[model samples]
Target: AQELLTKISEKCFKKCIAKPSSSLDSSEQKCIAMCMDRYMDSWNLVSKAYSSRIQ
Candidate 1:
């Protein structure tokens, strides 16, 4: 799970953060964080639903 999280973080951060500045800007970082969260949340929900359907 930790490794998956790191991979997701990297992909989302790369897409969202076009400019690699010294520090993550507040607003951009916030957006990236939220986007990563929602992405993972939806992924979990989807897996849950899929497993239920399969079972």
Candidate 2:
């Protein structure tokens, strides 16, 4: 979870935050939220597949 969160933070920061500011704007927040959700879904899917294969 830590590793995944770190990756999601980096990816969302690059993709959503166009300019560094005092804080994230509403749009940036929304974009990051959506990106994180998608990343988490993908991660979960991959993890399940890998675990199933190992078993």
Candidate 3:
């Protein structure tokens, strides 16, 4: 979970954030939300496949 969050934050920050700021704007928030969801979905899919293969 921590890894997933970290990865999502890093990727989303790079993709969604342009300049460093004290707080995120509405659009940045939405972008980060969408990015996190997509990353989580991909992570879950890969994890499922990896577990199946290991078993």
Candidate 4:
């Protein structure tokens, strides 16, 4: 869970955040939310595939 969050934070920050600010703007917030959702969806898909293959 920690690793998952760290990876998401790092990747999304780099992609969405042009500059490190004290707080995120509405656009940044939306971008991060979308980015995290996509990352989680992809992660779940891959996890399911790997689990099915192993089983």
Q: Judged by lDDT, which candidate is best?
A: 4
Sequence-dependent TM-score of model 2: 0.75
- Give all candidates' CA lDDT scores: 0.85, 0.93, 0.90, 0.97
Which residue pairs of candidate 2 clash?
Answer: none
**Which 10-residue window of candidate 4 scores lowest in summed lDDT?**
15-24
TM-score of each: 0.69, 0.75, 0.73, 0.81
Q: Pick the candidate with the highest TM-score.
A: 4
Reference-based TM-score, model 4: 0.81
Ranking by lDDT: 4, 2, 3, 1
| lDDT per residue (tens digit) for residues 1-55 in model 1 | 8987887788788778888888888888788888888878888999999999999
In model 3, where do residues sit more than 4 Å from their true spots?
none
Once all C-alphas are superposed, what RMSD does model 3 give against the true structure?
1.9
List model 2 lDDT by residue over 1-21, tens digit each. Answer: 688889999998998998899
**Higher-lDDT candidate among 1 and 2?**
2
Better of 1 and 4 by lDDT: 4
At residue 29, give the lDDT of candidate 1: 78
- Which residue runs does candidate 2 get wrong by more than 4 Å? none
Which residue pairs in candidate 4 have backbone atoms (N, alpha carbon, C) closer than 3 angstroms, thus clashing?
none
Error of 1 at 23 (Å): 1.8
